[model samples]
Target: MRDAEEARTQPLGPQGRLGRGSVAPVLQLLSLALFTVVLVVILVKVSKVPSYQERRQEKQKIDKEMSQLKTGIAGLCRPCPWDWTLFQRNCYFFSQSKRNWADSVIACQDMGAQLVVIKSVEEQNFLQLNAKNKGPTWMGLSDLKKEGVWQWVDGSHLWFSLSNNWLPGEPNNDGDEDCAEFRGDGWNDGKCRVEKFWICKEPAASCSSP
Candidate 1:
């Protein structure tokens, strides 16, 4: 009886005590899952590296092309009629002959040119310096459309305020002096019918845009 009781109290084989779990298999499975996640991350990084490299290479190519274009542009042929007096990168034709402002503009157009269109501070200064010394000279300015509001001959809004403002009480719009002229270190209304030296301007290239 004692022997039988001792035998029954003894533990059964390992299979009979399966309720107790082993950590080894669980640890191995978790390690495999973590390894799989790490492998995916590495693959994603490797896949993106080539794209980054390609983008960098494309940027470099663009930079190189821009540099080459700038270098080549420097030696590009300048516009024709290089003999024309170039002031501030613009060619000007100061009329030695006297003509009314409108007639002067028409003359310029006849020559495939336009009346001088002042565009910059340096240009205005240069024009003032190079113009006739004593007598008033007709410029590209006009107020025919809007009596008080002045505009360039090309219908562009005038921007040369500081360089060219009318002398105080000068642009009186007196019936006779409807045209404008640069005189007495400033602008003044003048007779468009009055013949006076004028200025003509041409594009660097005779080429017209479509």
Candidate 2:
């Protein structure tokens, strides 16, 4: 009886392996459950990557449909493509993908458009608001031909007096920043090779139906 009593009162050492009342096994089980829950969450996110991509594609399609022109018997009005945004009779394409300056120019050309040129104060204001919401975006301005002589993609010189929308002391050409981007404040010189979203501009497309 005394031996049994001593065993019952014995301090919990390594030899007193987990029993019903021991908290060690319970803690271990709780930790395993927590790990399982975290692992399951991670797996779920990984599995939904494709679904996220599909959802983005669907959203783009919906936007295109919503902006489509109304069909009429005599559809002679020039309108922007369903995917492009229209402003002041001009159609603009804000790229969803990021690319280097040269690649961005190629991308716009491929779409039968060119990188945007700020032709007026109205267009500048419009883009200022657009860029403020979209983060840093590349424009058609560059000084690749001659440093410090910025020109639009169309070979026209930038009129700084009329469109002096530079972010104070900008176009610094730091680290060979030959390309220009539209920021919240205005334009800034950026590295030509750095990947960034771009803007493309073109005349409104003529839509006709037989």
Candidate 3:
């Protein structure tokens, strides 16, 4: 009887515990699982940091390249050769020597350009300003193909209806006066063989580097 009473009052082993299993071992396993979950979360966050930094740096590099490209394009748009003047997308060369209109055309062709063609009031104004105090200069206009039918050097018909830079009472077709010249801020028909200073124009060359 004493032995039976002592066995009932003794502490139970793991396999003989209440309900499903031992509470201490279950608690320890739960704590270990929690610790593992926290460690995994911390490792995931740490791994993402480098990825975020790399993405940010890539974006900044792209932005910098874009900025440089914009600056390069702006530089490319205004390329002009040395000793030449830029106007819009074209370049102009003012001669320091005099030549006949025909010889002037040949000279410009040799230089990879052509005699200047007046296309706008602004261009005419610019030419006039540059011609200040200078003597009459040969232009690219002529009615050599047919009298009273003027044309530019490029074969485009002169739009007399839209605009005519001819001086008043001029182009009278007087005595083989087919070529044009700029004088006193206006234009006049003149003999092609007459020598005068000239202007040459051509498209601006593109820059090789950005």
Candidate 4:
């Protein structure tokens, strides 16, 4: 019984100490591997942060430049010439002097434009409003080529019939009335040689710096 107690109380031998020391080395290796994995993950995340910030800043700068370009274009844009009114994409000039239809055409040509051609109700209304308190005005329309067929100075056929806006009983061909005129808000057939104020039209100038 004494021998048994001595064996149980004895210190561990070299073999047991070697076994315990080996286990400690293995545990240390495992801990080092885990730390390396964590460090790699942190480095990868930190590397992406600057790249993401750079991309965001570049996108913001591009957007700011685009906005500035649009503002510059708007600032440079001009709508009409001096003494002219702007409507849609065209510029208009109302004459203070009277001229016959043929002479009016020549005058508009000299100004690098043509007699006004009414394309829609809006344009017609605009012309009428501006011509208020003025006498009859020559239009770009005439049936000189064929008495029954009206055409604009640009040679485009008048698609809609005169009944849409003509004065009552007009174009009676009364006394060789081949040219067209605007009196008040309605159109009328008048002699081509009659003197009248007119309107000239041209495309608006390009947007540019003065």
Candidate with top TM-score is 2
Would you list the clashing residue pairs of candidate 2? none
lDDT of 1 by residue, 1-210 (tens): 999999899997777665446667888999999999999999999887768779999999999999999977765665646446765556777777899888998998998888888787777777777773746888888888877777888888777564336678877988757777877577788879998888788766543332
- Candidate 4 per-residue lDDT, tens place, 1-210, comes to 999999888987976456665788899999999999999999999887768779999999999999999987778766777898899889998999999999999999999999988887888878877775687999899999998899999998886743478878876889999999888778888999989999999999877654
lDDT of 3 by residue, 7-70 (tens): 9999887656764555778999999999999999999998877687799999999999999999
Quote the RMSD, in angstroms, for model 1. Answer: 15.6
Q: In model 3, how large is the Cα lDDT of residue 23?
A: 71
lDDT of each: 0.77, 0.87, 0.84, 0.87
Better of 1 and 2 by lDDT: 2
Candidate 1 Cα outliers beyond 4 Å, as residue runs: 1-83, 160-164, 206-210
After superposition, candidate 4 runs with Cα above 4 Å error: 1-77, 161-163, 208-210
| Candidates by TM-score, descending order | 2, 4, 3, 1
How many clashes in candidate 2? 0
Better of 1 and 2 by TM-score: 2
Clash pairs (backbone) in predicted model 4: none
Which window of ten consecutive residues has the lowest lDDT sum in model 4?
Answer: 14-23
